[model samples]
Target: MKIPSIVFALLFTSFSYSQNISGKAYYESKTTVDMDNFGRRDMTEDMKKQIKERMKSFLEKTYILTFNGNESIYSEDEKLEAGDNGRGFGMMMSSFSAGDQYKNLETNQLIEEREFFGKQFLVKDTITNLRWEVGKESKQIGQYLVIKATAYKQVDPNDVSMMRRRRDRDNEEKNEAEKKEDTTKVEDPFEDLEIPKEVLVTAWFTPQIPVKNGPGEYAGLPGLILELNVDRTTILCSKIIINPKEAEAIQPPSKGEEVSREEYNKIVKEKTDEMRENFRNGGGRRGGGGRRFGG
Candidate 1:
C-alpha cells in the first residue's frame, strides 16, 4: 500500500517542524562597482584599479546567520589582518556596513546595530512584508532546490551608502558658477548625489528548510533564503549546517542607544550634512599634503 502524496507531505512537514532545529548559514556577499562611472572623469584606469583594490574589503564580505524556527541572528564573520584598521577610504565605506541584526518572525520585529561616523546606534523597526512574486522557475543551490521571488523594496532616502555620483558636467559648472557668485552661501553637498527611490530585489529560497528568515532585514519568505540580489550586490549562501552538534544562542544586540529606524536615518543625514560641509570648508586638510580639495 502506497502512502498518499498529500498525506506524506503533511507528515513530513509535521516531522520537520516538530524538532528543535537550529543551524547556521554562511553567505558570501559581493557588490560590483563600475569604476568608470565613479569618482572624477580625469581619473586614470590605474587610479581606478588602485581604488578598487583598496575597496575590496567593503565590496566583498562574508556573513553568518544563526537561526532557528522563530528567530535568527545575522552578523559578519570578522577577520582581523595586520594593519587592517579600516582607515582612510575604508573608513568612509564602513559607514555603509551594517552591524549585527536580529529578527523575530513571530513578533514581526527587526533589531539591528549600525555604526555611523564612529557612533553606534541600535535601530528597531518592524519587519517589512515584501510582496514577493514567486515564480515557477527553480534551481539547485547546493543540495537544496530553490525557487525565485522578486520584489521592489523602497530605498531609504538618507542611506548614504546607496548614493552615487551624477556624472553631469553641466551641473558641476552651474554649481561652480553659483559658488563663485555667492561665497557666503554654503552649497548643498548632496546636490550631485543620486539614489533611487526603489530597487528590485531578487531572492531564492528553499522550502525544505521551513524557516522564514534570511540575511540582513530580509524575511517573510516561506523558507530559508539561499541567495539575494539587491541593488548592485549579490549574496549567496556558501554553506549550511542544519542541526549542528552545538548551536549558539540567537541573541539580540543590546548595546548602543536605542532609536527607531527613521530616527537613525535622520541623525545620519544631519551628521553627514555637517561632515560634507566641513570637508568642503577645508576641515579635512592634512599637513604637508596640502588641501585635499581645489578652489
Candidate 2:
C-alpha cells in the first residue's frame, strides 16, 4: 500500500527537526575605551565627541553563532557599512579581525579564514583550552538558568588588532618615537605599549543549552555561554533557537591560503611595521583601508 502525500510530508518534517539539534544564537557586542589615555591634550571637547560618534560601528557590533552538538560556525552579521567617499582624509580604517571561524569540539580543532590587505589565510589551530572556574553563583537570563564562571586570560599585547587601531588613530604630525620615552603615563592612548596585559573574564553559561560553545574563541564549557565580559567588550547572547525546522550543516571554512596562527601573526607584524617605516620616512603610510576580504 502507498502512503498518502500528507502523511509523507508530515514524516519528512518530523525527521528534519528531530535529526540534529542545531541552533542559531544572536549576540549583541559592544566595546568602551578611555580616550583620555591617548594624550588628547589639545583636542576640544566637541572634537572628541565627533570622533566617538563616528566610531560607534567599531565599538558596537552584532554577531551570529550557529552550532550543533559537536561543531559550530561564528561570524559577524552584515550591516549597512558607512562608505569612504565622504570620510575625509586620514579616516581610512581596516579591520584587524579576520575570517569566519569553524570549530570542532570533538577534536579540539579550529579553522578560521582570515583576510588581511587583500591576502587570504585559512588559520588551522587548536582551540584555546580555557580554564574556567565555575562559581556557585546562579542567575536567570530570559528562560535559561545561568551560572557564573571566572577566568584570568593573558592577552597578547602585540596583536595586530591593537597595532591597527593605534595606527588608525595616530596623528601623522605627532612624533610617536619621542612620545614613547615618557613613562609616567600612556602618552599615546591609541598605542599598545603597556606590559603585563591580562583580562579578567566573567562568563555566564546556561545548562539548558547543552552545548560547549560561545562567541569568538571562547568555549570548553559544560553549557552554552549566554554572556561574556572582558575588559572593554561585552558579548551577550540575545536570542536562541533550538532544533528549528531547517537543519543547518555547520561546515568548516576552506577557501583561503592555509597557515597557522603563529605564521599569521608574523605576517601582520611585518606588514604593520613596514607601513610605520614608510610613514616616518615621509612616503605616506598605508592606511590598512577598510574591511579587506579575499576568498
Candidate 3:
C-alpha cells in the first residue's frame, strides 16, 4: 500500500503533537544585595560579612516548577534548615514569602498559599498579563536555546518585602520642640520603605519547549521561560526533565482561609502596622519577641 507523502507528513505531525507533555524545571533563585542597604552603618566590616553569610540561605533558594500543558505548580524545593539558620530572620522574612503557587493558563487563574506571620491565607487572583517585548537576541541556557524578552511589571505598593528603606535625613531645621512632639507621636517603622510603581523584568525563554510557563508569577511567553531577571533577583533554570516517569499532580492550594490578593496584602499590612505601633510604644516585648526585618 502506497501512502501519499502529504498524508504521511500529517500523520507524523499528529503523532508528535498528540502525546501528553509534562515536565519539571529546577531553578536556582538568587538575589544580589548591597551590604550598605541593610542600614547598619554601625556594624563593623566583620559584622557585615557575617550578616551577609547568614543571609545566604535566605537570598539563595531552589524551586521546582511542575507543568503539564495548561497548568503549572511552582514551589520551593524542601530542604532541612540548618541548626544555625537565622530563626528570627526566617520567621520575619517568610511572612512576606509566597508558598506554593498554582497557575492555570487555560483559565488565567492564579492560586497561591501564604503564611503571613503565623496565619495562613490562600490568595486567589487572576494571572498577571505581561506585555513582553520579544527580542532577537538568543542564548544557550543549558541545552535549550533561549530568546530574550523584556517587560515592565507594576510593583504592589503593599508588598513590604520588595520595598527598600529610604535613607534617613536629619531635619536640621526642626526645633527641639518639634522633635519632642515627633517623638510623642506614634510612627510607622516601615514608613521609610518604598516600592517603585513599576520595575523592568527580563526573561529568557526557549521556543523548543512549547509550554507558556515559568517560575513565580511569570508566564505567557511563547515557550517555557528558562531564566528570569527581576528586581535584583535572577531565577535560572538549572535542570529540565521532560515527560518523567512520575508526574506531579498539579493541584491548587485549598487549606488556608481564601482571600483575594488585595485582601491578603491588607491583612499583612495591618498586622505589621500593629507590630510597629507596639515597638514604638515600648510594648515590643509585650507583643512577643521582636522579630523584625528592614531594621
Best by TM-score: 1
Better of 1 and 3 by TM-score: 1
* Model 2: how far residue 34 lies from native, Å: 1.0
Error of 2 at 22 (Å): 1.7
lDDT of each: 0.77, 0.69, 0.75
Off by over 4 Å in 3: 1-19, 79-91, 167-192, 288-295
* Superposition error at 250 for model 3 (Å): 1.3
lDDT of 1 by residue, 233-265 (tens): 999999999988888888899977899988988
Highest lDDT scorer: 1
The order of the candidates by lDDT, greatest first, is 1, 3, 2
* CA error at residue 76 for candidate 1, angstroms: 0.3
Better of 2 and 3 by TM-score: 3
- Say which prediction, candidate 1 or candidate 2, comes out ahead on TM-score: 1
Backbone clashes counted, model 2: 2
Tens digit per residue, CA lDDT, model 2, 1-295: 1223433343454444433568999899988767664334578878777777666766688889999878999998865354442222123244354669999988999999887766778989888877788776778899877888888887665564533223244553455545556533322222443323667889888756767788988898767899999876889998998888986888899987898878887877766555554444433423434222345
